[model samples]
Target chain A: MGESILQLQQIRKSFDNTEVLKGIDLEAAQGEFITLLGASGCGKTTTLRIIAGLELPDSGQVILEGRDITDWEPNRRDVNTVFQNYALFPHMNVADNVGYGLKIRKVPKAEIERKVEQALRLVQLEEYGKRMPDQLSGGQKQRIAIARAVINEPKVLLLDEPLGALDLKLRRQMQLELKRLQKQLGITFIYITHDQEEAINMSDRIGVMHEGVLEQLGTPNEVYYQPRTSYVADFVGNANILHKNGETLAIRSENIRMDGESVCTLDAVVVEKSFAGGQLRILFRLADGQLLTASRYGIDNDIQPGETVKIGWDAKDAVKVIDNDKDENQR
Target chain B: MTKTKTKGNSRRRSGNIGLLIPMYVFTILFVALPILYLFLLSFLQRAQVWGVDFTFTLDNYKRILEPLYLDTFWQSLKLAFTATFFVALIGYPYGYFMARMSAVWKRRMLLLIMIPFWTSALIRLYGWIIVFRSNGVLDKILMGLHLTDQPLKLLYTYPAVVVGMVYSLLPFMILAVYSSAEKLDMSLVEASRDLGASSWTAFWTVSFRLTLPGLLSGVVLSFIPSMGLFFIADILGGNKIVLVGSVIQEQITKGRNQPFAAALSAVLMVLTSVMIRLYRKITGTSQLEGML
Candidate 1:
């Protein structure tokens, strides 16, 4: 939709003899918040590091704002990264840490002070300017890290699981805060995280990775509703995958209705049922002995573990995914 | 049940106290008592062959203020500081390189630093003597190569003494700085660089500041032993450079003034304690608990 601010063409990286990134090609539009989402060791962080110029790709081109910056060092690149640990300077107070970039550029003292105040206020940490990083809580430290990065006003902002260190509630809150900040700043953000919920909640586009390969890249809705591979389907959310010919048909647990009015109805015995907040998660074993999970809301009727129930879903809800074997072969 | 639980707790507390008493007794008997004795000995007059006729006097300390003994103390301090300064300057980069190296390289380089420790300090000083002597390998090679008309008098000099001390104490500095540098999280350095700081700026602002504790300890390690050690100066300095340690040795063996030697030893110990306290204050480090 806009000119590409950052582009990675066929980037490859390895540690020792093990390949970590296998020819990753990705592009981020101006003002886009793209997340590289995957499980651990899936090269999501490696890709983000490559984009930030922290790690050199074996063979690739990194173009930023239409300039080939593949060989640019991290300090030379107009990009800043917020590490998961925050990595705040333990010796420096909040204002000094935030203004470090400006000071490095030899900006005027008054300008640096003004910018630091503005940045601290942006992260709602105006009063924390005199405190050291160790004195701050995890959430406050994360916000300081964000303030430090945003103070630079780089063309691209790389985040390596910036919320991974926070507690669950704090992480959720930071997720909203980060999204809001991204929208307000409109800088291209290349975020890396293993948390699928975080990726789905904050990203304009989610690139799902599996074992150093990009499985699929799309909007969150597309990744959830129209997964291109079995790994993506299982990685993005809970899915009941059934093999049909060479392709795997994946149906979301919530899409499989229990009314038994659909064409593909199977007699299943309820194996387990869990009351999870507003929804009930019912695990079932079909006549073919295949396990399936289904979620139903506001269902007062209780189903015993051994009780037989007819489970069905419309054919339209079953998205076809390439079989694991086929996907591996393609790679 | 409550009585039994209380009894068990009291037994455990007594056991812990029992374990702690021996450590306290050992420390007091071997460490604290000797230091206290030395402090008192410094203020006493010399005894006449263990006759137990003692008088409190500051004569030994006053004698040290004379030019001959005073120069030795000043020289020892200057030499110790010089060695410590060079050790830090060289060791910081070496330690940084070691920290950034791969495991294999790090182990190999650490072994290079440690190999000297396995050998005796005297033997290492002997090795330096042989290398720096008038007709030793270094001089012979230089003369043979026609680099100079005569064999240079390098063996018995202040530079030779400084060089030997630096060689001996450099490993401690490197190891101390290396331990700190190895534990440093690389993300912080990257964060600094990402903020547009140059490599040198990042190193000074973040890397060096974080490793200050190690550097301070290393300085202390190098300074303390170098001050008290007269062997390197005795061997390489040709007995011309009289350090505080040489003065103490002279008072005991050559001068035959045991009480004065004891007084000098006490003064040196006090100086070391003061230096250590100052170092801890500056670096905000507690009394170093781990082996250097």
Candidate 2:
């Protein structure tokens, strides 16, 4: 319930007659880390660009700090963006790259140097100030990019999958680093990413987008546990969807337990068992020939493929969604 | 078995050396031999039937150091530099436009640049003459507008020579810069702007610096050929100006002093090599492979 630092009022954008952002209505509270999470081509990056003033929305206004900045140029707007590729200047060393914005603003040289040092230290790259981008590792370059944006001290920081280029381990580490940076800076963060785990880990609130529309917006648990749409449930986490008497029921794979202990059990056969790290994803074919997946934690029991198994979940765990046919009719 | 392998390697090496013999012969005949001949002629007083009295003197070098010939060389250098400066000034923006243009528009622009190249250089020079001569297209149009009573004296001047040289060498500069600009990652510019720099600052700090190699290559392409070229100066300068190239031509054709011309040619070659070496040093690029 903090003041809204950024708002997109019915924003829409299209490219070459193809709509990319149908009508996105989003608001970010001051110092809140909000993530626009969706799959590729879901208008998440477009929305982030619109907020950064890199792309002009077709209709509606982008209000920043309670001011309408729809026509403001990127530099005039009090926002900075970190691109997915890092886009670190290859010709510049890390210090110059981080101090570029300050130099552009004609800040005092001494103050610029001090802020650059502080920014580099925040990203844990104090000694890499002299290294060119090509000489640094991918993670180091990503940190430099973060330093470059954060050094500006903009009102809102826009990140378009900033860690998308890193490998899995580095990406996880940088995700935590970014979260810490956001908390320390206490600035509004408008982040866009296709990675659901990243959104859940870093964001206080998440907006799920699908095909240029903001499908659902809520906290991570709200979006994951109580998705209003099937796309949201499937996109946020693993969900087993079932059509029961025209209502769409989505049950998390982990919620389905071994059959004997539950009151509602369904007869199914284990078709495929995949050992994925600490959990096993068991694929089962129900009696109605519907394929469903159940995630069993820890090392899976010695259940072979083509073996008969009974799986069940409590009826209360099944969250019913508005049927797609009815929703399409409403649209 | 290893001895046999070694023997086979040596045999392959010898075969490769034999294959290189023709390449060496061609280079000696076409390149090295001419340069050696020029060097020998530069030091000779005159040529005899078989050989001269084997007298070594520095008169050819000293003659060029005199005021008249030295003035010509200095003027030529100044003109070449001016032409090269303008070529880069116009070509960078043109090449940038080409690089950022859509595929169809880029092709059209590239064709526009190359249209003049399709005709002969001599024909183009003649066309310029027709345009700039007294009572020519330009003079006629100016007079028709009552801008001047007499035709402007623009047909034969340093500016005319510079214009001709720049017009001739511009395509080379554009093509050189375009090759580099085409490969640049445009996202970097966006990133610069997104990180709080204006478009102008981003262009200078990110885009321009990245395209430095391209600009250097363009300058070299325009400067070197324009330095040694005399036809444009002779045709456009009304034969009143003398450059190193004109001196060489005059010695070979009218002056009938082959040795002096050869010496001047050798000097021009040395000047070109020095410029190239200086460029390589300044840009931190390698000479073996062309600039990237």
Candidate 3:
């Protein structure tokens, strides 16, 4: 692991008395692709914008390469952002858009042209430099946005859902391409996405956010399997937060096996079944009438509604998570 | 591709054409007929006893080429151009403010801009006269404040005409520019700054370029009507300067020279077209300036 190259300390922001990013503390290492994962209005984008100097924190320090830059203007900082909407200049051609930063710095014309060509080639759109943004497809616009940010070669590249507007297949393809580009450039990438699957596929670590605060920050497996709070467990995927003996336990959907050999067996009756693409999801009800859903791969035609099933999971599979929502809601 | 389908398509086409008949009739009767009549009238002679004589002549066109009338045309252009330039300068910031304001303030600002349109233009011109007349509010205020020894002539001047014209036409500029500014993708401005562009450069490259259509529309809308506001010159100008509007008015009303008035109108139309072309070229809005 590399040293921590970017640090956000107690970053706080608000708009008109409504808090957006409430004292967010984050650390990102060099050459690492980290994602800020959360739903809309959860302050993920606000945190990323603050880190890039596009926004000034209400009270905090932003140390970039060990230099405090909290009050620096966005143009004065060595960070770039790929906005959520691509934000390509509709009037300019691709080359001009990609080379805008260098041009503003008054770089030599020949060098600008060469760098623009190199940037376009990096995004696999070498022949598209002469086309206007409106003439390009949605995926193409996203690549141009990436190329525009990459051409600056900033220390940290903030991507605010660059693949958010593309089709599913195209989003998957660009995810891999972006990972490759981040590796090739060795720049720290701070990606913001609301999709859990997307963050898992492309990030070395993901920061989960909710209500203007970071809920947890860890590797994808650690975040998924060892969530620290009930909110994080619920946000990551199907969260089964069970109350046993006045203690909270979080288990993943895939861990709960049906009618198999394991520890912690419970008898429940099948209530509902759904046929998904390759998996059959069965919802079960305990004697106390609590609902539990289990998914098994392929069609298990034998299991029907009203059938009693034995569900079991190993004792080591579940993680103890604090049920903060119940406590906070009571306050 | 099939016979029955083609017949159904033809029937639908005819139905659509029938729906547009009222609009087509209105355009032909009120718009096209007047313009054609103006064109034909410019070539006919104006007789003293019987209104327009049938004899075709180029005398009306030739008379308008004289320096006396040409100077009025030039003066009108000077006023219109200056008013449009200053309007753009002032209205652009207002438009940007309106665009960036919160929803509540945007509606309030838009309502303020539209307040003047509810009043009659002639009434508004008379209101200006109250401030601009000799020893009126402006002169009285200047003397009352000991700013001037004598009541400086405030009305019957070129500046007065421009003031009235701008006051009457400023809303067009603001609304036209506001339309473009409101639809601007604000993320583009943020992206420009993030890409190492200073605030001014970001505005020039992204925000300002994207709003060119609105700016050009403002210029055209403000300018075309300023060319025809003879009433503003009539009241505020007080016969001191014979603008193109006043000259055309004099020919049609007092001089009884319909042919010369028609000829003057044609010249103004041509000039307006030329100026619009120049505006389009300078603003880089020839392709799709009116889209949004």
Candidate 4:
């Protein structure tokens, strides 16, 4: 990350009487990969669209590279977008689609051809230059769309869940590819996605959004180990939230142990057990009717349901988080 | 059990083909037989009375090459070209904009375009007559606006016939362009804009090229029919305009020479097929039939 390159200040938007975004403020440093993470209808996509100049906020300021560009046309802004559906021009071949921005700027034919070839090579689709958009597979189309957007050498690239249409395996491959491309080009990326894993995996900082408000913006470690709010804790990863003595606390599922020396311990019953992804997860219920989950490596088939057990977690692992129930009620 | 089910399906498939017999008969008798008879009549000699003689001759075909008939063909081509030009000019933007509208407005506009089809085209042409006639709706508006002190005598003119042709055939062009325009993905246009192209550039490079098949189909639909709509010329241009259809009608009814009329019709059919072939070559698809 370098100097601040883009900023959104007090952005608010409403559509047909439904407030889609409250006042949102954010800053992105140059060459930074920031992910807006949220579920559907959480205003992440709308925020991306606003930054891309596809949508205008009801009241806000979008500053790009120290310029107030809130009213600038999309073409006039120094930003490009990779749409979710990979909106390639069906009438044009892969080379033409990649070279469209250069052609629009009246770049010489030879230069555009050379740059298009270089861009296609960057995306590892050099031999697909003559193929029409409909002839390409979904993953290939996504790469072409990225090539097309990056060809303009935009200052910032906005991606609206560009890998959402791919399967899980392909999506993981593309996530690594996109991170590599962002680094190789040194272009700032503002990505929007509903998948927290993708956000945590690829982002320099993840902005966890919920109900038109940003819950927290921090590094993946900070967001995971030390979430600022209960919503962020529950939404980011599996957590065992506990409330005691008028205070809210959260502990990672993996932090709780079946039998270990710890700062706090409780006697409980093993209520349920399941194995997934080479890990054994067991649910424990205390006499007070409070449920806690504990995860361990490998399948521990010896632990049967309804058996007596003890659960313990260190005090350092339990982080106090703001209970948003009252805040949500106020809003 | 599966074998018996497949056997029953095969029997039903054969029964389905059997049900199409009336359609085949209707097509052969009404469409195929008339065209065959007309082709045969074109090669036969005209009777001294009111029927074609059985004797074969090439005179009727050669008679179409006469200067008077050639000029009639030229006039027909000219008027049809002009009408198709205006139809595309007005209908393309009308349809493209209509597609960009909201769904409710799109449905309303489609309804507006289709309402004319429920009425007889002749009656609609008559409505135009009331507008184009001297001291009619158009002249009254012009005079009331003080644009002209006297009636413009717009009726019985070439422009009036062109107007009639366009008015009668515009919905075809609009509907054709609308169907393709509605299917065009707007995100592609947005992608173009996102790639540093302006709105106008995006429209020409992406939107226009994508919808071209529809526009060409609309042109063909309007062009082919305008050449044969003799009633439009008869009602609007009075005796001033003479098209190939008017000449064919004259040879059939007034001249009582069915062979010559068949020869004229055969030439018109050849011309239309040539146009359709050219359209197919340009679009590389049989989209003309789809438009029809």
Query: How many Å off is the CA of A328 in candidate 4?
Result: 2.7
Q: After best superposition, candidate 3 residue A178: deviation in angstroms?
A: 0.3
Q: What does candidate 3's lDDT look like per residue over B2-68, in tens digits?
A: 9999999999999999999999999999999998999899999999765899899999889988999
Q: Rank by DockQ, highest first.
A: 3, 4, 1, 2
Query: What is the Cα-based TM-score of model 1?
Result: 0.93
Q: Over 4 Å off in model 3, which ranges?
A: A260-264, A328-331, B1-16, B280-292
lDDT of 4 by residue, A1-331 (tens): 5999999999999999999999888999999999999889999999988998888999989999999999888999999999999999988899999999999999999999999999999999999999999999999999999999999999999999999999999999999999999999999999999898999999999998887888899999999989888888888976888787788888888998666465436788998999899888889888788888888897845879989866778888889988777556532
Give the poorly placed runs of model 4, Cα more than 4 Å off. A260-264, A267-269, A285-292, A329-331, B1-26, B289-292
Please compute DockQ, using alpha carbons, for every candidate against the native two-chain complex: 0.82, 0.72, 0.86, 0.83
* A1-331 per-residue lDDT for model 1 (tens digits): 6788888899999999899988899989999999999988999988888877778999989999899999988889999999989989998999999999999999999999999999999999899999988999999999999899999999999999898878899999999999999999988889999999999999999999987888898999999899988788888977888775556789889888877585546788999988888898899888877888898787685778999988788889999887665656764
- Looking at model 1, residue A22 earns an lDDT score of 87
Q: What are the per-residue Cα lDDT tens digits for candidate 1 across B239-267?
A: 78888888888877777776688778887
The candidate that wins on lDDT is 4
Give the runs in model 2 whose Cα sits over 4 Å from its true position.
A298-310, A323-326, A329-331, B1-29, B48-54, B145-149, B287-292
Clashing pairs in 3: none
Clashes of 3: 0
User: What pairs collide in candidate 2?
Assistant: none
True contacts kept of 4: 0.87
Residue pairs with clashing backbones, model 1: none
